[model samples]
Target: MVDDTSLTSLPKCCLSVVIPCFNEVERIQQCIDRVLEQPVVGEV
Candidate 1:
């Protein structure tokens, strides 16, 4: 079994979003802006 104390001792984690697009020039900026607004999203 896993220890709860060990989990609590771990450092905070950040998340990165990866978006793959081919021809999203018109909406890419909008997508990026929305992702940046997220509290846990560090990079897109």
Candidate 2:
């Protein structure tokens, strides 16, 4: 098992959110807009 000290020293990574839209033409814009509002810390 890993130790607590090692976990704390580990580096942080970015997040990637994937959405599935079948026929969300109206709500698709809003969904993408909300996600862009957040800060992207990881690679794209």
Candidate 3:
């Protein structure tokens, strides 16, 4: 189980992963896949 103190120590900051595209229906899956595969190194 994750400790409450460790969770509370996390910084309050936004982690934005902007996927800018006009028509991203096809590429959206790939974008989401890549984003989800990435590990949260710092804030994200």
Which portions of model 1 miss their true places by more than 4 Å?
1-10
lDDT (tens digit, per residue) of candidate 2 on 8-27: 89887658798787999989
Q: Give the TM-score of candidate 3.
A: 0.50
- List candidate 2 segments past 4 Å from native: 1-12, 41-44
Q: CA shift at 7, candidate 2, in angstroms?
A: 14
lDDT value, residue 32 of candidate 1: 88
- Alpha carbon lDDT of residue 42, candidate 1? 62
Candidate 2 scores a C-alpha RMSD against the true structure in Å of 4.5
Q: Which digits, one per residue and each the tens of the lDDT, describe model 3 over residues 1-44?
A: 89998998988765678778679888988877778776752432
Please state every model's RMSD to the true fold in angstroms: 3.7, 4.5, 6.8
lDDT of all predictions: 0.82, 0.78, 0.74
The superposed Cα distance between candidate 2 and the true structure at residue 29, in angstroms, equals 0.4
Residue 9 of model 2 has an lDDT of: 98
Off by over 4 Å in 3: 1-14, 41-44
How high is the lDDT of residue 16 in model 1? 67
What is the C-alpha lDDT profile of model 1 across 1-44, one tens digit per residue?
87999999889897767777679999889988989898877655
Task: Give the local distance difference test score of model 3.
Answer: 0.74
Could you say which candidate leads in TM-score? 1
lDDT for residue 14 in candidate 3, whole number 0-100: 54
